[model samples]
Target chain A: MPKEVAIIGVGYAGFRALTPEVSYKELMYEAAVKAYEDAGVDPRRDIESFVTVAEDFTEGTSIFDEYVPDQLGAVLKPVHTISGEGLHGFIAAYLQVLTGAMDIVAVEAHSKASNILTPDEIMAFAMDPVYNRPLRANPHFIAGLEMNRYLCETGTTREQCALVVAKNKHNALYNPLAAYGASIAVEDVLESEMVSYPLSRLDMSPRADGAIVMVLAARERAEELSDIPIWIRGVGWCNDSFSLENRDWTNAIYAARAAEMAYRMAGIRTPWQELDFAEIDDTFSYKELQHMEALRLCRPGEAGLLVEDGATEIGGEFPVNPSGGSLGMGHLLDASGLARLLEVVLQLRGEAGQHQLSDVETGLAFGWRGLPTTSGAAVILSN
Target chain B: MALLEKVDKNIEARAWQGEIPIQSRYTCGLAGEKFFREIMENGRFAGTHCAECEYTYVPPTIYCERCFAKLDEWVEVGPEGTVQSFTVLLVAPDGTPLEEPDILALIQLDGADSVLVHRLGKVGLDELAIGMRVKAVFKPKKEREGSILDIVHFVPVNA
Candidate 1:
């Protein structure tokens, strides 16, 4: 039998599109203090190990894991870097507890995107040197091509994509830390300057600075630690084909596989009605639509209609990304996944005040990574 | 061959020795790793032609990791090929907008199974197409060597 793991504490520090006033270390410390308080445990005492999700390219610093210790107060402790996003880090931490390796482990992911001077150069460098890099194409051009292909395959309109932007940004208006929340309209998104053909300025998530942390504990430690423990019922992560040219641009195969693995592990046969609420990453307006189809929240191409029907609103059948997702919250790379997981934990604990939904027990969180890798992680959190 | 000769910087008077950074990275597979030595030496471009898989690559890579077979036969990629894709970059990674556009293109070196990314020479976005054929124009013969920059660019074939 596998040992169970539960989140005993969670903390967040930023949703700022640009954080210029404070040093990056101070930004992380702010969240660390909150996480330690919520976990009701000290890093130097109760926490057994630390795991951080970070990448060298995002921060423009190599071997970035070295800088994590000073900020989080994890001095002289076992620390590991997952080199991916938050949920990937979350899975690594979850397995640590499940394998009986340690009692209490903390996972954190953060981003300081606003500080970076050249975001596209970093992404372009990620391409295959021989074939892709020579094109000098902005990464968003791929999003444009893929979006065009998606519209062709799914018969969805640019209007639907615009609606996703409008709805998510509107949802963020209620969130205090939401960076991109505004009274945007479908026409506004459609009329936005075309960054890549068919993909407007509103299509992509704005880069932002933020930190999110979660403390996971073994079942016994969790039960003793807190009255409200959100047990991680299932954790799954997977990757699809790497070559973007060969891939079917319309579908998120990796997300579907990830969702299936998590659903099976959690014994969830029908996710649509069974899962209470979800926090899916909407890095781009169309991504949410594609991922919703991939997660089987609605059938492929039905997400546009689902959004229009008001079925995914806060009070509807499935309230998605009540904290506003990457659209409102801003794109913090590895931190975005953890933010979704944090929302699930908060909603399950009845701590999500304004965006709170009724009778929420089970919550799902999804994350999609770049490199056109079709990489994603799904976690089921329940009280 | 002598990059420093063109710059005409008087190194004798400088307090610190001049430095021209040439740091670049390469992706190495079985074939690519073995091929790098050949590329770094002579100015010739070569690739493996596997009997079993019939796979050919320019700037020869080694054993086919895909087919799991040792490939020894070499094939030369021609000086001309067709463009698979092209882009005009207007912004740098740090969100700095460029003053002028740079054309980057993927060229399928003739006789190779795959394409190599390189700079395109003297072309406008409006004049280019996905299949427009082009040929490699090398640096002056005195400068030709194993480096990727041995060939200045793949200029339009008809141009």
Candidate 2:
């Protein structure tokens, strides 16, 4: 078996609908400072590698990695970028630690989503230029169609999907970092103006600006470095078909395959029974249920019933997304997965203040690359 | 930390907004060249067949995604297909509400194992259903440009 890796420290800055005051670089620096301080490590001296997750189109700049080093305290150091979700970056850092190439590595991801003006256009640009982009349709249409298919095939209702919005946003009320916390009912989600058929504006996670940095170390160093280290029990990522036509619309096969790989690594055969909670992707209301099934937290079509029964609430059995998730915290673009992992870490350390669950030992964090892509990553963490 | 010190309340951060000018032309690859040519010249659809997988890919590619077979077999699919899934768009890419909603569907072209995403035409949002048969409506021959758009839209065929 490979050497174990543990998240020794985590820090975040900002989780708001807007952050006009801080530039993206400032966001990274703030999170980096907090992370380094929490880990009690001087980046220039202790950390051996750094990874930042970002995309050129999302950042409105080419070679986005060129801008990361300075803010991350990685200047003149070995640093790299992963044009993938934040958890993918975390997984990369984890693998680096496992390889014995680095004892301590830092993973950084942030969403200056507030900085994006043409958000939908940027998403559209990610489509097949020859086949799909020419249609000039808003990219969320893909999510809409997927939601439609998922609901139809699984017998999950639109109201059941709306309940996810209500549950997550309601849970966010306890999270100080959450931006879109609300006490709205399912009707509010149902009544929200439709952006695409069966997908309402409220059902989608609004954008937020935030940064998160995590320090991971080999097990020995992890034990020596921190009082509360969350062990990375398993990490897995997978990419399904890039062609939308070839994908399983009803199922997040990417998430399922990623979870299977992760569960195998963690020696977890029954995720719903083995894990205490999950902070999976909920970029859209229906996605929460779809991911729930994909993660095998519950049987297919049963996720909707679980939400309706409040079994996934913060105090409920096997509570999921107690940190408010993207729905409550606002989607942080590529950084969304890191935000999810941050919550699991905080909760594992008994540091999640208001929304903390009782007697929780293990948690899961999953991320989807979002529309026009079938890539996903999953990580299992235990204290 | 020195770089992130709080600026005075009155200080306006100096920043400029600008757009980068970029231009490029995309080459429809080996498979796309054949696929689009068939649409433009013959007003038909073609897919590459992978004998090993016994699967046909619409909007064909040179290599099979499943078994990594070099696909040299070309098969005609459909000008007619069944709607696999669909959505009605209420907003444009720019977030502006469209004057009239547009419907888009993933059509499983007959004879091909894969689907193609295209616009749905002559159908109301209330009337569209999954598994509904639809036929391609192509633009005039002279206007055909060897593009996916050569097929104007897919309209519902007789039940």
Candidate 3:
């Protein structure tokens, strides 16, 4: 029998535009302290492994993982880093506990996006040098291209995409941790400065400084540690073609594959009916609609209509991103996945104070590595 | 007793400014070598074809992505193609407006399965539309350096 994994604790620090007073180390340390306390585990004594998610280019440091263990209090222990998104780190920790090699594991992901002054340049550096890089446009141009194709193929209007921005931003107004919270109308989003055609300024999530730490343990260890442990029923991740030239711009094939693997493991036959809510990637407003269809929460071309009908609102039949999502809370880069998982955990535990939804026992969280990469992860959580 | 104290507002936050100096040289692999050579020597676009899967890859690759078979067949594709998707950028990567807004398009070159992303010249945003035919405009042969930029930009086929 496989040992089940549960998230016993979650902690985070800083969801603001800037955190000039604290270094990335201090941010991680703050989150670590909260997580250790919430899990009632001493990192020095109980944590058997540590995993962090970060990219060297984003951190502006080579071998960024070397600086992570110290703040996490996992120094000289089994600590490693995943140069991918936060959910990838979570999946790594989940596998560790499943192997019975570790009883309790700490997973950390953070973003010091405020520190990078030239984020667009850094993003361009990740593009294919001989081909895409020479174009010299902001990386969001890719999103613009994808968004236009998505709308054209699906018959989704720009107005429907604007609804997502309006809804998510409004939803953020109730979330204390949200930095971009607002009660704006769709017209406001439509009128925002156009970054790339079909993608406006409001369509993009702003960069923020934040760190998230999650504590995962085997079932028996979890029951002993926390009264309300959010069980990680299933987890999956996938990467499609690395080249945008060949990728399907109309659909999030990566999210679909990842969701399929996770759903099969969780025995979820009907995602819309089985899962109560989701915290999906909304780095771009149209992405929320696209991911919904990709995750099978709705049929192709139905997500935009569902959002327009208020079906995805907090009080509606299916609530997505009730914690305000990346658009509302701000994009945390590698930590974005963990941020979604954190919200799902909070909602499942009935601890999502003001942003709480009723009768939620099971939830889903999705994460994408954003533009220039067709990589994504999905995690299913149940209380 | 108070456990927290606030930092003085008058005190300035200190930060260090530095950059990692790194440069790289990439070998245009077997596939890239063939693709770029054709562009540099022949002034035309070429793609690799997999007979088993009947798939043509633009920006050619050595092996078929779908069938994993070695793609040894080369076919000339797209001096002309259709615009599959496009975007007009109001600002550059450095956060400044160009003298004129730039039009970028993903051109699905003729006889290829994939699209090439490049700038669209000689067309305004209002005039550019999906399915609009466009043709690659290469730089002067002497100025060509076997790079994607060797083709300066793609312009409307009629233009």
lDDT of 1 at A177: 71
Interface RMSD of 3: 2.8
Per-residue alpha-carbon lDDT of model 2 for A1-383, expressed as tens digits? 24389999888998998776678998889999999989988999999999999999888899999999998889999999999999999999999999899999999999988778889988998888889888889998998899888888999999999989988998999999999999998889899999998899999999999999999999999889988888999889999888877877778999999999999999999999999999999999999899999999999999999998889999888898998899999999999999999999999999889898999888999999887889999999999
Candidate ranking under lDDT, highest first, comes to 2, 3, 1
Compute each candidate's TM-score over C-alphas: 0.78, 0.98, 0.98
DockQ for each of the predicted structures, in order? 0.09, 0.63, 0.56
Q: Which stretches of candidate 3 lie over 4 Å from their true place?
A: A1-3, B1-10
Worst 10 residues of 1 chain B by lDDT: B1-10
Q: Write the per-residue lDDT of candidate 2 for residues B101-130, one digit (tens) a residue.
A: 989999999998889999999887779988
RMSD after CA superposition, every candidate: 9.6, 1.4, 1.6
Q: Score each candidate by Cα lDDT.
A: 0.77, 0.91, 0.90
Chain A TM-scores of all predicted models = 0.97, 0.99, 0.99
Q: Model 2: clashing residue pairs?
A: none
Query: In CAPRI terms, where does candidate 3 land?
Result: medium
Q: DockQ: which candidate is best?
A: 2
**Where does candidate 1 chain A have its weakest 10-residue lDDT segment?**
A241-250
For every model in order, what is the number of clashing pairs? Answer: 14, 0, 0
Interface Cα RMSD, each model: 15.1, 1.9, 2.8
Better of 2 and 3 by lDDT: 2
